[model samples]
Target: MEPDHEVLVVGAGFSGLCVGIRLRRKGVRDFVILDAAPSVGGVWRHNTYPGVAVDIPSATYCYSFEPNPGWTRSFAPGAEVRAYAEHCADKYRLRPHLRLNTRVERAVFDEDADLWRVATTGGEITARFVVSAVGPLDQPKNPDIPGIDDFAGTVLHTARWDHGHDVAGERVAVIGTGASGLQVIPELAGKAAHLDVYQRTPIWVFPKVDFAIPTPVRALFRIAPPVQRLVRLVTAAASEVIMVLGIVHYSKVPFLVRAVEALCRAHLRRQVPDRALRRALTPRYGFGCKRPSFSNRYFPTFMRDDVDLVTTPIDRVTPKGIVTADGREREIDTLVLATGFKILELGAMPPFPVVGLDGVELGAYWDEHRYQTYEGLSVPQAPNFWLMNGPYTVTGASWFSIIEAGATHAVRCIAEARRRRATRMTVKRGPHDAFTRDMRRRMRGTILAQPSCARSNSYYFDRHGDAPYVRPQSGLHVWRRARTFDLDDYSYGP
Candidate 1:
């Protein structure tokens, strides 16, 4: 059987769009970008809750090749970011190659033909190579609470937010106080009649340095595009200093943590005047253990008269409201689940079984053996299969840079395979194992590897308390390594 396409890219997000744009530039036309959603943007499309904006600075968040000149603020809002994703798809003329609302169910490797048999909601399609760009935090996580289904008033996850629902007069209950929760709570503070934020684990909150870009500045960016690129470079370098001092080299200089923690405390004290509320919001664990949120209004929102910070252990969810362990039931009309996503087990299976060599299901194999990828791109047995935001590939900052790095690496691999007249290309088992081992070794003594991480309810850890999701390295480190194409690392078959 002939292949449907030379390459099948599963997802149309930042990583997937990068693949599409780069493939077109590389003169590779036989490819299609498939997305389960009706639109292009992945998380940006789904998350449209009020006050939704990026945590990272907008300058460094964009592509190096396609620097956006029209960003209104230093930290762009979610709507603008989503529009940027659409702009990329349009600018690259990728719409012709996009298959929207088509979810890929399963993809199995055909050993004999050195091809992939991909099954989707539409039908079966085949490709010579399969690239999985399904993001790490795409799947929304619903809390394991009894009677969650019974909550009849209104139920919504932050990712699947219902904007039409009238939150103006409703008593809203927001579960979890992570990044999403912090952003959403501030927006709901004024609108909701009463906002009860359930905090199981307190997270460190710092001030957000967000400001609108003046018209003259934007005009200058439009005229001199290199000016914007220079700004991006400067922003990235500043973030790297924080990554090295506060995160990567934490064990060597422990005082760095104390200094950063003091700054966070000062920020909190300046915002919240009440001692009890300040104590409730304060995080006990060391900084960088879990993801710290950046917001100017998150702390001040708690001071509002209508808002109630609930620290009680939730026993279960009732139809009316939440029942606490102390038997106090706080009745609420709406439930907003800011609980986050399944990160560690990200994209393990996409609705159906991904059978690789010897009929090993990808999900079950990962559950037992954990992720085994060569530089978080190619696996040992999965030939011509590459994952975009795969295991241990996520850096400390500059997400777009990381995406670009992975996309370029995948594109290079495909080009090399074609040059060698190879039908199958897979990472050698030795190199794959060595990389995974090295990542584990490097994780030792880092902030995430410390015992304090257990105190924080972060999605970084697997079942055994090991962080299989984080790269534990700087963005520059991964970016440089990805650009360095080492052909000896892979094994090719004709």
Candidate 2:
């Protein structure tokens, strides 16, 4: 049977956009980009909190092919990132292929027809190939605290911020001090009449080197694209060094982690004078165990007279406010949940039910056997299906690096299938197992395998005590491997 389209891309975010762009470039035009949101940009489009901005420098946060010279700051704000996504969509002429406000429910492979019958909100759509670009962080995870719904006061989630709600002059409480909490806490300190910061675990905070780009620099970048490329190279190299030494090569170069931890300690000492507060703010785990955040104002904000860091464990939420484990209750007018997205969970990995070959459910299989993939792109039985972001795929500090690598890998496979005039292209079990074994072997050298990481409360390590989220390789190595991997690893047939 002929398919509805040649390929059906599952998302319209950075991953989906990159895949769509690469597909078009490969002369494969029969495809559509579907997104659940009203517009494109994925997380950038959804997350619009007050202090939302890229944690990394703007130079390394963008695509290599498309660099914006008009960034106002070295670390561009969330709006600018969203605008950049929109710019990419428009420039690449992806607007015509986009189906907005469409959510994919399930996708089942038809063995006889050798195609995917996808079920989305809009109805059924079939394709010869299905690319699951739905990112890991697409679904927000709300804390399962008792009586959370019983709160009569105004409630807000960092991901789904309400623009009309005013927090000024109101008593506010922000829960969970992760990346979003780090950014929003500083912005909420002075604005709210009184702010209470609930902390389950303290994170390593580094001073962010953020500043505005001068007009002259912008002009130079625009006129001489090579200059911007040079800047990207330097920034990317710096990020790669941190990922390699502080994370991947932690066992070999433990001093790098100590140096970084010392810097963070100094930064904390300089910002917070109270010794007790400093002790409460320090993390017991290793530096690279959990994803560390960078912020100039996060630590300093704790010093504000109006802002009080509540280290006591939360017992439950009442209609008036939150009640601590020690029986201390704080009455507040508003509650802001800074709880982050679901990263390692089964629901997050696929975001929906995906039935592959022989009645195997993708999420169930991973949950039972452990999450493993071939180069984080293909599974053994899941023919004609590719995941742009999968287990053991994330390489560099910049997410763009992973997207580029995964896109190149997937597009290469698809191109090979076309070359062979094949309808089915599945990764061989032998190669997939070999790659998974190698990844696990390399993971032992990383910080995630350390005993101290057990206290990290990090989403990086799954329930199986394995850190499959990172590829344990440098960005350059991952990129090179993606391009030069042998096509014989996959089996092509009619």
Candidate 3:
């Protein structure tokens, strides 16, 4: 058997890119990075909708090692973020090791051989270690509404923004008011002659304190690590307030939660003077449910004369427009589906078929609630296979932090594999089960599972019906957990 390299990193997005970068620093250059797309930036590259920008401040949205002193906007847009990823790849000279436009079809852990046999849409590759950083938000999800395909007009998911399609002066139907819709609607509001937003459930919206990071301020931060760290700390602390009120206190909605709900209501009422329409747009859920967005401009978009909020259920799509269950017909040419991604399929398995240990399909293994892995990194039954950003790892804060954490964890696992001189390693069943169960128990106590949690379709849950992706605590906790690894927690077999 030949080694594709010491490691085969899946996905060239932030997670995989960071993993490859750190692995290179550790002097392991014999690795390859694969991505389904033709370039980097992952979600940022794909989600190029109008008004697409980071909800979080730009102060903390970067690598701990490298800081940018020239972000034009405080809340940088998609292009800047994508450019940052591209810069990282170029600065680190990571393109040569990257194989773009190649998708992994399948990967199987050969227990006896002690290696992962990897197959791709391009070709087969063997590696001593396989790192999955495919990302949690790469695959766009379409709503289960019947005839979504039957829409005679152009239907586009936010991720796959159709640059070629024109919505100008045309009537449009925007489905789903989640983060994507919030960003796109405001940009599309004035363009479309008439816009109808079919919102199933109202979402918690807060004002985005977005501003510009002046060049002097950026220069100051470039030299002073303390300033940047302080900014990150403040933002982290503010985000933590929501986590405390929502995640820890799952039972009751706190008073601040009430205040936020009221504030959002007031904003809606103030912007859209029509009492009837304002009443239709107010959210019934708590502020922190469903990853509340901060947008100072989102609500005002609804106030536009041409914009209308429709809470009615959709019967189906006709040739020219959407027919609501209430029997109203809204004619539209373009339909923008702001529905989210298939998050579970993100750390996507290979395209062919992955048979782990005893000829078991990887998908079925997870389906049986046995997607066991140590620290959500490596499976005991699966040799030389690793998952990054796999489970219980989403941070409302910068995912740059989580990606680095996962990268740190992956580097450690690779080091352990090297030290053991083993062809592959898998976490033992007992520990894997224990950790996963502990994660669930912790999450159930979070605001994410509360009764007021997002009634809308969210990709936060796994098949086992658990908040398997969100980190229930601090970003620092994740960093610390990934930085330090205990081999005893995992069983190493050759």
Candidate 4:
């Protein structure tokens, strides 16, 4: 089949929109953005759980190119973030090229035709290039508790929150104490008659430094956009310092980890003065072994009379309530599962199968080759295709930075292919292997590679117990590297 367009982007969220915006800026307009959902904002749109807001400062969590001057708070809420995505779509005039509620099932590279044959719910569309921006955190995971389906009461996963289900004056059981659980538990604690929080493992909680963005500051950002950029740079620098010194080198610099641990302990002590409660909340694993959460009210919410923290391991679930390993049953009217999303383990090949050259499925290839890729954007055998937010691309810094870097890299690659009038472009196997070797070497002594994470049930690690999701370097390094595409790393063909 001849190419229907120059490019076909498989997502409509931050990474996808960034691709469209960058492509348009580079004078490439023959492309379409397709999303499975009826709306934009991949994670922001799905996770409308109560008290959900950005953990990072709003100044740094946004696009470096497009600064939002009107954020109400230092950390914008999910709604505002979704609106910002919509604003970006409008600003870039992307709606005309966006196909919502259209899911791309599979995309196979036609070796002979030199085009990608994409199969979708809407219809099959061939393109010269395919950009997979389906985010890592888009797929929500449910717990594997026995008899989970037997729950007679309403069951809701925070990712698939049922707005219609009323939990007011009802006994609510929230499973998991991850980021989403921390945010939602606080909000639900106020409304539920009684809330039972099931915690399989304790998470390190830090005090959130959130406040309203004053009117004057917003006005200043509008008047001088450079001020907003300055704020972003400052925020980025601070985060980078901690990441490089503290997290990336936790084992080497114990004091750096201890200092942050001291702050976390102080926050917990201040919030929960009760000795027993504080002990229950104290994490046993290293600080960076598991993902840290930030919230001002999460600790204090436990002090409330209506909330109960249940650390007992769940044995099973009855039709009426949950059963603990201690053989105790707690009845609840509503169940909220905040189990979190499946990161990096996007079902081998997420959304659908992607077959590259010689009818080799991308999933099968990765399974045999161990997720080797060139800068997490292009795979060795995946010709004329790139994945945004792929394995080893996620970092400790703001997600927007990762998206921007990847989108820029992919757009430049496509532009180069067009400039050369090449029918196909595939990453060289030598570069892909070299990148993988470096990733494994750099990951040797990191916090995630430690023994503590083995039992932590952290999504950071791949099936082989290796943490392949994190980019093993500073966010700034990745950003700069992505800006300058190494054309020598790829092979162009006619």
User: Each candidate's root-mean-square deviation in Å?
Assistant: 1.3, 0.9, 2.3, 1.3
- Locate the minimum summed-lDDT window of 10 residues in model 3: 344-353
- Highest TM-score against the true fold, candidate: 2
Off by over 4 Å in 3: 249-256, 259-263, 345-353, 370-373
lDDT of 1 by residue, 1-494 (tens): 56999999999989899999989988899999999999989989999988899988999989999999999998999999999999999999999999999998889999988999999999988999988988876888999988889987899899999878989999999998999998999999989999999999988877789999999999999999999999999988877766666776788877887788898899999999999999999997888888887888999999999999999899999889999899999899999999998777635433246778988777677767776578878787688888888778877658898899999999989988888988899898888899989888888867887788888878877766677677878888888888895877999887
lDDT for model 3, on a 0 to 1 scale?
0.77
lDDT of each: 0.87, 0.91, 0.77, 0.87
User: Which candidate do you rate higher for lDDT, 1 or 3?
Assistant: 1
Number of clashes in every candidate structure? 0, 0, 13, 0
- lDDT by residue (tens digit), candidate 3, 1-494: 66767789888888888988999898888999988899998888788988898877887788878776668887889899999999999999799899999988788776656777788888888888888887767777788877677778888889999888888999998998888888888888888999999899777776667888778888888788788888877876777666655455545546656676787777676666778766777776656666668777777777788988888899988888888998888888999999887765423422234677888776566656534456766665566677787766776557688778888887887888788776666677787778777777777767667675546455666666666667666776777888776766766766
**For residues 211-318, what per-residue lDDT tens digits would candidate 4 score against the true structure?**
998999999999999999999999888877667667676668768888888999999999999999999998887787778878889999899999999998999999
lDDT per residue for candidate 2 within 128-215, as digits (tens), equals 9989998877887889999999999999999999999999999999998999999999998899999999998899988899999999
State model 4's lDDT. Answer: 0.87
Off by over 4 Å in 4: 346-349
Name the weakest run of 10 consecutive residues (lDDT summed) in model 4: 343-352
- Global CA lDDT of candidate 1, please? 0.87
For model 1, the run of ten residues with the poorest summed lDDT: 344-353
